[model samples]
Target: MIPDADPSADQAPALAEQAPLTERGARTRARILAAAREVFEERGYPETRVAHITRHARVAYGSFYTYFPSKEAVFLEVADLLFQTMIQLDLVPSDGYEPATLIRRANRAYYASYRRNAKMMAIIEQVATFNVAFQEMRRKHRAGAVARSAKAIERWQRAGLVDTALDAEMAARALAAMVDHSLYLWFVQGDDVPDTERLLDTLDTLTLRALGLRP
Candidate 1:
């Protein structure tokens, strides 16, 4: 018979004691975030204030500060949450797919999220110009995003789909620039997005060819 497992091995009485408080903190944070989104969407980032968020959240100003230091901090947290929400949608391509297939999936993921979170997306665009801190935050976020894309391109090269000689970082940055510009154009087009599927397919072709992959 197997020896009895040690009872203390999995025991975390300290954590058990703190679990409720941790959960409550998370709930309070979520409430503030929800309130912030509404406040920002309604008043625009420049006009929105921390007091508005606290009032909307039905929490005291001190409670709001206890959870987040400032309105900008809360907005950044919203940005972080939006990024995480998109990640949970599995925008990243799987290793099993060819580069083109991966590109299609990634594009679809972006377009879908862009539509679903249009309000937050608009706020993001506004803040990128309206807030200096948000601009820096976006820069850092883009760097990380591009780094991941570069690694993915390197993986594709190893898989024999992309040219091994192409500089992964350069290709990734170019692709990021291209996708970003395209999204800007799409945003300008608004509800009149004609032939979106064709657009994404064309983007895949263009990006793949840019990476020295045959279309």
Candidate 2:
């Protein structure tokens, strides 16, 4: 869950309910969240310190606790903000397009959103490796995406667009896995990220081919 690497630029709204933030307090909290994102991205979660956050935010060290309970709390807020932004992208292509066209368009949108948040996503994967709750959250997130794709596949199958023999749920899960892992490899792990056109075209080709659409 990450993008707009300098979150301060957007000034993400505070998470969870609390007494309304005074204008000054709101600004300070936003600063801390922005700074925390920077520090966490720079140092990774394990290496990040409250002190680092305070210094970068330029807030008094003790004031960190006034806004957040702990490093984990602040991290969660920052992560949740990115997650919200990332999911705001509706991957389900709207009506009127052919199924194959919808798939390509959806994949392109997914790639763009993922690319914007790639830096935060790498850290999310790292944290999920050991954090059970976070791991489960990741699973749930993927499951939701897979479920959406499965429904789309089922619709396409009914229209005689997709191969009927294919199990919609299983096929969707495979396709979702393909897209997710490939993005991680291309954007997060690989040194040479492909040009925008190549990146979208490659995934579009592979996904469309896998769905038994024209190559």
Q: Model 1, range 87-185, lDDT digits (tens) per residue?
A: 333434363445566676776777677668777778788788778776776776566566667877787788787789889888877877776667666
The CA lDDT at 84 in model 1 is 51
- TM-score for candidate 1, please give it: 0.80
- In candidate 2, the residue pairs with backbone N, CA or C atoms under 3 Å apart (3 or more residues apart, or in different chains) clash, namely none
Query: Model 2, which residues run further than 4 Å from truth?
Result: 1-20, 90-93, 191-196
lDDT of 2 by residue, 57-154 (tens): 99999999999999988887777677656645543434556666666667776788888888888888889778775665556556655665677777
In model 2, the worst 10-residue window by lDDT is 1-10
> Lowest-lDDT window of 10 residues in candidate 1?
1-10
lDDT of all predictions: 0.69, 0.74
Against the true structure, candidate 1 has what lDDT?
Answer: 0.69
